[model samples]
Target: MLLTIIYIIAITAEAMTGALSAGRRSMDWFGVILIACVTALGGGSVRDVLLGHYPLGWVKHPEYLVLTCCAALFTILIANWMRHLRSIFLLLDALGLIGFTIIGCQIAIQMGHGFVVSAVAGIMTGVSGGILRDILCNDVPLVFRRELYASISFVSVICYWLCIHFGLTLEWTVVTTLVFGFSLRVIAIYFGLEMPKFIYQDDDEQSASSKDI
Candidate 1:
């Protein structure tokens, strides 16, 4: 029940962010719903499909689909207010990412998967939606550059694994992972911390490469 509530919150926040992306692209209502659903559910769907998890999430619980659509429409109604609240959205996005990762980890563990598979499931749960969103919006995927996003997800999964391995209760595991993951992500955002980038450059002006990305 707690996990289900968290999942609802995660999808709602994600759909809001996705709607903002759609608004930036000046999409119609249909486009807004499409992007919102993709951003909110795409990751979990990808993970489920890869793991051969039957029935799928949205198929079993169509209410999630309705929630995303409603959240998208709500975002559209408050578009201007949203622009002024970037930091709030950032925090929400961080929460959503961590929440999704935790859920993904739980699902994999329930399915009798091992640590590595759970970690991959966690990462996919975190970033698959963003990848689809970026591609649809015609922007380079955020996970591919300029941020510690995907790495944060992987690190969170590691933290969750450690907590479980150390014999922590499920509640403690969830709280620990959520706090650890959220802190890392917000700190990364605030300090502009990121992974080292490898720029592919020609021999000519090879040293002209910059690190702005």
Candidate 2:
């Protein structure tokens, strides 16, 4: 029940963000709806396909797709006020990331997968939608460039696995992971923290490496 609620909230929030991205590009209403649906449902679809899980979530529950489309239209209506709600949207996006991660991890565990596969599932579910959204928008994917986003997803999976391994109740584990991952993401955003970039200047070493390749 809790997971269902979180999933709904997460997808709605993701859809809104996707709509906003489309708006930034001056896309039409249809484009907004398309991007919103992809941003809300793409991650789960990718995870299910990779796991060979039959009957994808949106496919099985078409209402979720309806919800995302509604969310997209709602965002368009409120586009004027969105600038003032940036912080709120960021927090909601963080919540969605952790929620998606937990849902994916739980599903994989239920399928009797080991820790590594579950972790991958969690990370994919957490980040892939935003990746698709950014790609469609022609922007760099935030998961790759944002401060501690995907890393937090992975860490949340580890925390969730540990909680379950140590006999935490499912409810408590979800609550704990949500708090931990959400807090980490909020802090990362506030601090503008980011993973170190490896900048390889084109020089003799790079030229030689390219030639070898």
Candidate 3:
């Protein structure tokens, strides 16, 4: 039941993000709903399949689909009233990412998975949906580009693992991790915090060549 609620919230966040992006692209209502559902469900589907979680979470709980569809539709209807969909989208996406990361780690731990495995699973759960969404939308996934992205997931999972190791209750551990992760991402966005650029192996050569010209 709790997972179901989490999935609904995840879908709502993705729906808002998609609707906002779609509006910027001038996509119609159908496009918005489709993108939202795909963005929200894609990662969870992959995770379940990879973990051999039978029936998949969405298939086992059909109301999740209903929730996704409704949430996507409702967000689209109200999107026009918002003056700055971009900001809202960023906030919602960060929140959903945080919740997904925490829940994924907790679920793995509940199933007796090790900390390393749970951390990786949590990062995957947080980023994979957005990756798939961007791929389908023909844009680069934000995870691979600048911004805190997957690092936020990594930090969050680590915090959760620490709390768990310290004898903290599962609920509080998750709560703290979610708050930490969400706050970090929000701050990163607000302050334009991002990953450092990777200088390619031949960046020096390229720079030298350009300078010579």
- Return the TM-score for each candidate structure: 0.92, 0.94, 0.84
Per-residue lDDT for 8 in model 1? 88
Report the C-alpha lDDT of model 2 over 1-213, residue by residue, as the tens digit: 888998999999999999999999999999999999999999999999999998999999999999999999999999999999999889989999999999999889999999999999999999999999999999888677668899999999999999988999999999999999999999999999998877766687578678665
lDDT of 3: 0.77
Q: Give the runs in model 3 whose Cα sits over 4 Å from its true position.
A: 1-7, 23-29, 201-213
* Model 2 segments more than 4 A misplaced: 204-212
Best by lDDT: 2
Candidates sorted on lDDT, descending: 2, 1, 3
Which is better, 1 or 2, measured by lDDT? 2
User: What range of 10 consecutive residues in model 2 has the weakest lDDT sum?
Assistant: 197-206
Model 1: CA > 4 A from native: 203-213
Q: Candidate 1: deviation at residue 135, Å?
A: 1.1
lDDT of 3 by residue, 172-201 (tens): 886788789889999898888988888655
* TM-score, prediction 3: 0.84
The Cα error of candidate 1 at residue 25, in Å, is 1.4
Cα deviation of 128, candidate 3, in Å? 1.1
Write one digit per residue (lDDT tens) for candidate 1, span 1-213. Answer: 666777888899999989988988999999999999999999999999999998899999999999999999999898879878989888988999899999999999999999999999999998999999999999998788967999999999999999999999999999999999999999999999989999776656554565434
